[model samples]
Target: MKEVKVEKLLINYKTLEEFKRFKEYGHQELSMLEDLQSNIVENDSESPFYGVYYGGSLIARMSLYKVDKKYDQYFEPQHDYLELWKLEVLPHYRGKGYGKSLVDYAKGYNLPIKTNPRVNSHGFWERMKFQKATYEMERDFGQNPLIWLPEGISERNTQ
Candidate 1:
């Protein structure tokens, strides 16, 4: 397989149109569109959405958000971390390493990462070396979170 390039998606109608092809397209994207129409966010401004394109069409995407230390509950030493969500590769693009490419891109940050894997995707996250976060009723709130820790970082002990 050729190298996959994960890119930061620009917030624009074209990008939005491309996103509709994704199954995960819903509130997150609709809100972005509304924000664009209302001038809440500029068309080409930086966005949390990132994607992989194939033949000039978006084939995979994920959103990465930096959560402040004060809100960090998954990593030891309480530092800033990335919250990864909405990772999806179009049906035809699955198994081509596009999903792994997007994940590998997130790991490039070298920060502890957290994500709630979609049902049946636990195996994939496990393959990426992410471990299940210890459940804490208040923090977890029924979401089964998986986490990846970078060098020198450890999972926070929740008790």
Candidate 2:
């Protein structure tokens, strides 16, 4: 498999246009566009989005946000963690490891990661060594979160 370079996408019209090709485009992206149009943010501002381009076209992407420890209820020791969302690969890019590569890049941070995966993606997350976090009504209402913990870390039981 060819190595795909994951890059931190900047907030720009061109980058927003490329995002339209992704299926997960929604409010977060719209908010960015609004910020750009209103000049509230400068072009090329750093965004939380990271992606892999194929032949210069973005073929896969994900949004990773860091949640401070004070807001963490998913792990033991109450440490900061990554909240990964909107991970999507173009239909043609499936099975080529583009998604996995992006995930691996996230794991390189060495912080515990959390993601509420889309329906039917359980197998992929499982294959990535993530396990379903025990659900808590107040903390996890309407979300089924999966988590990946680095060595010497474990989930806090919410049951």
Highest-TM-score candidate: 1
- Residue ranges of candidate 1 with Cα displaced over 4 Å: 24-40, 135-139
Residues 34-99, candidate 2: write the lDDT tens digits.
Answer: 433443265566578888999999888888899999988878888899988878887788989999
Residue range with the least summed lDDT across 10 consecutive positions in model 1:
29-38
lDDT of 2: 0.80
TM-scores, in order shown? 0.87, 0.86
- Model 2 stretches with alpha carbons more than 4 Å out: 24-40, 135-139
lDDT of model 2, residue 5? 93
Error of 1 at 76 (Å): 1.1
TM-score of 1: 0.87
Clash pairs, candidate 1, are none
